[model samples]
Target: MAAETDRPAPEALISAFEPDRLLKQDQSGRRIAILGTIHGKQGILTAERAAFATESPEVLKAFHAAITQVTNLGDNDIYRWYLASSGGTNNVTAAAAAQQPPDLKLNLIWPCTESHIKKYSEQVVRMVTETPEIYHDHVRPYMSAKREEGRLNWVFNILEGRTEQEDVILRDEGHRGGAGVAGEYHYDDAFLMLPDLNWDRKTMGSLHLLALVQRRDIWSLRDLKKKHVPWLKYLRQRLLEGTVKMYPELEKDQLKLYVHYQPTYYHFHIHVVNVMLEAGATQATGKAFGLENIISQLETISGDEEAGMADVSLTYFLGEASELWTNVYGPLKRGEKPQAG
Candidate 1:
């Protein structure tokens, strides 16, 4: 048996089989290997230089001399040497490569600086007060016709005084064979009128006309596009240049115009102006083929008044057109359907 003092320590006993210690020694060897690799790289560089000297002695001599001269110079002196060398004879040409600009990600930060609530409140007030006359004069007549035709559920009027007696009867089932009640209407003063700014009336009217045409089963989308876009484009150009020229007063007012194809309604119409208006001003206005010169043009094209059934008065056309336009372009009220009436 070995003496207690001569016995190997516990750590020494573990060290013989310790994988961790072995791993540490392996890591140390790896570090030495890395250092040796660096040494080898330096050696490779020297060999490469020697090979270059053998292949191109004059170039190698020039490059070596330049490097030696640069190494001896001070930092500032070295910079000046490099600058001079860049412009000097036998210059080492660096190809001019296109430089890409640094990417600057600009996130637009929109701040709610104005009081929208106040602005909207004022708009509502103006719309409620000023829109009635225009609606009554321009939109109500056609809506009244559609209502009489039993093709519209209700025609709202803000222009006329709201009263229970003024309620336009949209459907009369009591009539024999459902004969339409045309031109029978009234107005009420008690009913609350919706603010015009709350809705886009021109878009509403265009959509309304679209829905009406769709329900009537007249005109395909392609036909509407073919017949309408070109005509509207021409009309729009004419109105901007000719009509506006005729009525130069319109130039003072701000104007925005748009034309869109509504598949469901299958008709083309024009939206003009903004929904909101200043005090004593009008809300958004739209002109439909049914309301504009396109009606007469259609009549001429069809060569029959009945074939071009759009020869109604602007007021008459607008009411029905408004409903269709509203259906397509305006926001709907509760329980409103896009279908006719």
Candidate 2:
């Protein structure tokens, strides 16, 4: 396991922030970007790293009470966004502010830097065509190395009930009936759903959820096989039903289900979002593959049950910093044998 690093809470960092300017804001005003300085003197040569402060009880109360002005941005179904302010009347005292930021509710990117700014900002993206040969020869190996390096420790922490237990929306241990029938289902089929970190939990329009499988045999969508169609269908139905049940305002049709090809982590998980949410690059064609489409392909695929996505060619984009790009794809583009991850 990678040694965990001790870091300050977002509240502590926010309390000591010195505002410079609003860097950027988008996502229909659901998010904001600000550039600011902190009082840390350790990194004189390097730019400060960024941190995020979460909403707390005190901050949430002030945020709700300090609305002196409001400008409606737009709405999707029952969801609404606005640009509002407290008219600066609810400002905290200097002493109070100095100790911890005023009663303000805002996300922070503390210890941030110019590099992070560029990373978050838009940049040119290139698409790569990944044939089955490329996947077998390169991508699979790279994924294995990443997993071996303990990159999935955080995922295991959640699965093992070591962290974020309270946030779990639903956990299905593949139980269909009494204990006698439990053996009929594979243990690997067990999964749990949770609110994605990007979600504020209150925004119905921007609803984003994740369903992470308990099994480790399947790393990415590429590992899915025709035999798993039943499991896939079962998962899809439960996820959709569970989300709508959690928020009575949403219908099953309002949710969109998909999985990323080159997912951020190697674990098998599905991304469920409100259809009304804006389709960003994360939902782009080369990245997100619809669960329904994938299932249909699997059902009709001309092969034995063992045949699956591994036999098909997949195309997607990779950041320049990605290990696959630096060690594999980049070398291939230069007409050299790709290096191992």
Candidate 3:
């Protein structure tokens, strides 16, 4: 397949293919995989269809339309769309709905957002400096005072003492000898309030306050509100407009954007939640879905992560799959594509 730039817009391709006209297949609980091979690659198609049939006869019946393109997935691409209804619950709720499903679900496997990252990075820095009391009072006293005295002899003697008493104290206090202390300590409220600073398990339960302090690009609250916040709002608006225009047959509330933040890496991205609608709802009024949650979550994450001490391990939810795609249609605007895809 050719590069993404070489391909027509995804909306155009999706429109031309008429996905609704494609057959729907049920796969009983088997995984529904979409494979993109070279265009006119009969061998690949044959193999894929055979695998599909073998996996579940119900799936073949539900198999929707497949569009072969020279772009999108790759150059000379044969894109296959395997639609199965039984793999998992859609778990998506329209924003306008008064009641949401107890177990509504969405699957969004994508990167974090830039605004989230920038905001969290700034918050983490502020937490370190502004709330030094949380650290100095609760965390700093635990550090070895002897080390601060520059008494090498005492430090050596302490280190050489392989006694059980020293080991117990060190274990309780962390490596620096403060009881109940970890490598990096943070105010619990400060940490919990910000959802944006928390990434996945890759960042939780660790301390890197010193490292964060050394970084010069940590964002400020004002900068985040002025730059990232507005950008996200703009993105949300664009997505809603584009989806409404492109897929008039679909319900407006079906588009969702699931948002998350990654501060350590300094990047932010969005995941889109998509819902398939029946024909009856095609003429219904469009309603924005997931924008409020996205904004709230971003604010909470950013605020919490940035409220504490430096070198603290940030903890926050990794976000569920459905949450990610709740409001993702914004990037699909006709002429608004990012220079870097």
In terms of lDDT, the best-performing candidate is 2
Q: How many Å off is the CA of 338 in candidate 2?
A: 1.3
Write down the TM-score for model 2.
0.66
Structural RMSD, model 2: 16.7
TM-score of each: 0.19, 0.66, 0.25
lDDT of 2 by residue, 1-341 (tens): 23345566667776677667665443523455567777753211113323323368887676567554454443322223444443355377645534541222233344444534654665566678888898988889888987896667768888888767788999988755432211344534689998776565666777899999998899999999998887888889889889998999999989999999888779999999988787898998889999999999999998999999999988898776566777888888899888873
After superposition, which runs of candidate 3 have C-alpha atoms over 4 Å from their true positions?
A: 1-72, 75-228, 262-266, 276-291, 297-341
Global lDDT scores for all candidate models: 0.27, 0.74, 0.28
State the lDDT of candidate 1 residue by residue for 89-145, as single tens digits: 343333321122111111121232232223223331111111334333433343444
Among all candidates shown, the one with the greatest TM-score: 2
The worst-scoring run of ten residues by lDDT in candidate 1 lies at 205-214
The deviation in Å at residue 180 for candidate 1 is 41
Segments of candidate 2 deviating more than 4 angstroms: 1-123, 176-188
